[model samples]
Target: MINKRINITQKNFLLFLYIVILGLFGPVVYWVSNHNTQLPFTGKAEKNPIQKRMSIGEKILVKANNDAAKQEGITAFAGGDYVLAIEKFQSALKRVRNDPETRIYLNNAIAATTESPFRIGVSVPIGGNLNVAQEILRGVAQSQDKINRNGGVGGKLMMVEIANDDNNPEVAQQVAQKFVRDQKILAVVGHNDSNASIAAAPIYQDGGLVMITPTSSAETLTAMGNHIFRATPSTRNLADTLANYAVNVAGSENVAMCVDSDSQVSVSFKENFTWAVYNYGGKIAPFDCDLAAADFSPEEIPSQAISLGADTLLLAPSVRKVKKALEIASDNDDRLTLLGNHSLNTYSTLKDGQNDVSGMVLSVPWYQKAIARNSFIVNAQEFWGGGVNWRTAMAYDATQTVSQAIASGAERQNLQQTLANPEFSTQGATSEISFLPSGDRNLQGGLVKIKPGKKSGTGYDFVPLNMDQIIEAAPKPSPKGATTNPRVKSK
Candidate 1:
């Protein structure tokens, strides 16, 4: 009985040990069966969830590092350190292969680092006619500041070295000559007046310097060929538009043309005005005045309009001179209707001679009130504060255009090409502008009539002419053998 009891105990102990071993190996056996493999349970297996989360965190850290490197690269490029910028950018690109912003920065850095043989210099008449030129420069400076703050043009800040011309043609020529001889300056912006621009044009062409005039309206400047460019519309275009409006819209068959003989703008105005008027089947009763003549004598101008029975007068004198001429003309005949250029459209006309210019018509390329609410105008105004002049908006547009072209991979030699193929148009305070093939801005010149105010004591009010009506009134030119103006003899 004692032996049998001991055997039972041993059997029970072995069974318990077998159960314990099976419990431990159960999970391992199941895993092995599921994976179609054998199990080795010597070491513990890791939980996959924890390992996967850790891997994800590591990937996020790498992306953050790449973004940081890219930002640093952009900073380096803007600071003019191209070598460091390129390395950092390349490193960042490895991490993020398809970033447009990164690609732009890289392009800019490359352009800056690469040495070019052509060096272009731009000049501005920052002084003289302090109101106009200063306003222009202020706009230019502000625009440049904005561009530099936004990482510059293709990573290179435009360094403009300004020299004052003092509004003197001789001084302008001398300054231009200096820039040409330096070989670093490839272009000039100034000689604000036509006389100054014309004087410096030969020098610029001879020196291979591109002369871009912002204000000169000389007819001869455009004839200088590709070397010269002007941002302002030619007086010729303005004059033609005015003449068409006068003969067709105003219904004036006979017109008296008066021009300041001494002024280049006046010369251009006379030439274009005469051509456009004659082509439109209107007879011109001519009168020319020496703009420098101080006297207000009508004999000095010697108008043939009165003798020829013309009731309408086309006045192409300076704003100040026009006021004098109008005052003189009013005394002679109050019935004479007056027509003028955009120069006469000013606050001074309203302030100085409200009665004299009460019923006159003029053509202008831009109107300030038309674009006063544009965001660019608002931001530019805010940025410039009281320093913003109405004309500065045009300057801002010009500068922005140049910067954008450069940023778009325009080489120095290919500026004209880039300008010709401008991919963008900017809204300025005065006008929305894009360049045409002739470098003339694609803008509409409109007629505005100065009319007496409804209130007896109030100043004259400006009324915009009906553009559609004006277009319809003008005689359609025959496509086949249209009568063309006789070309004026070039001096």
Candidate 2:
């Protein structure tokens, strides 16, 4: 009986061991079987030709969860069967709607099947601000579609590929390196932030590649290099427009300022606006507030400004500090005229500061209502299912500028020269496109005032201010020896 029990116990123990081993290794075996890239037993990843072409992170991002159709499409593209590549890419997109890489591949494949094709890189912060990234991409996509449909630039179709820099300076440098290495990519369209642009400008200059920024407005970028160009107006242009309106038109020459010190564009805007204000016969108030400071008191700043003889409160916050700027606006409560740099022209302000920021003015590079490019507007709305913003317009202009340069048969060696030539001019979404010696756009900024409206779907809209509104908002002396602008306040 003791022998029988020992045999049974051994059998049971062996069965339990087998079950535990199966539980531990079942998923591993399944994964190895499912993934063709894994060697059966060596436990090493074997990259295919397409995976081998990508960086490790890029391979993970692209192929880790990538569908079979996308893999097939990539293979077809590598094989130079552009028609098959396009078909496979389109099929892949139907399943993965928001895959920017797939969209870029599709665009490139379509361009390849055309008579003659040229490639450009559209670099943006796809991982950081997806909305801004998509906005810029829409502009490029629209321009590509329009140009190709209208017979392209001198019969050469423009193909675009998306590069996600994630808005980090280090990543932007990496992207710039990659772009410079790809000799086929003659021009690049972005690096949206000023810091990112500044970080990558030298790489582009060294590589003899042309890089045009659609939204970066730092003054430093103006002198970076001849290879660098800006489609958007500089900080100086934005400041001049706002300062002129505040000093000459609105009679709010004595301005108190709130600045974000952490942002390059914000600090640049503050310096330029200060000089412009003094030039326009205005003075910066002594009580300047730093929005980025940990001890920032939005509520206290306004009352102090009013007490210190400031009739205008300039909110020069960066994109990161717009919330604090809006807080200052709300706390001010119609006591002083509110004005801000282009950074404040955000959907957040329109939505969150509905009544508080109603009468506040913001400087922007482009506004669709101000410029009546009806065809571009109508087609963009039809394609994007809504209206686009200044970023989109500037991006369209940048893409158009590159297309024109490419159309002139300018390759990497001569593209910068072609763009910098005095006679190089092309029509853009905002206006005529041309580069100055500093590579800044020959453009001015426009001012828009927030007003109660349903157009923005936020119970308010950024209405382009007319001359009458700008000139008629000068403050009058109140009975209590205070300045008041009843005309500029929301009712």
| lDDT (10s digit) by residue, model 1, range 1-491 | 99999999999999999999999998888788789452332222142221221110112212223587787785786577878887887787677653323433454455456555223333444344434455455555555556666767665665444555655677777666666665444345555667777778787777655666666666677666555666667777778788888888788887876666766777787788877777777777745445456654664343445777777887776533556655544554455678877656555555566776777888765444544476555665455443233345555656666666567676545555666665755554456657666666665566777777642234666667776677876785444313566445554
Worst 10 residues of 2 by lDDT: 51-60
Q: Sum up the clashes in candidate 2.
A: 0
lDDT string, candidate 2, 265-361, tens digits? 8878887787777766678888869988989888899899999999999998766678899999999989999998887877788988889998888
Steric clash pairs (candidate 1): 108-154, 120-186, 121-185, 121-186
Looking at candidate 1, the ten consecutive residues that score lowest on lDDT are 52-61
Residue 188 accuracy (lDDT) in model 2: 92
Candidate with top TM-score is 2
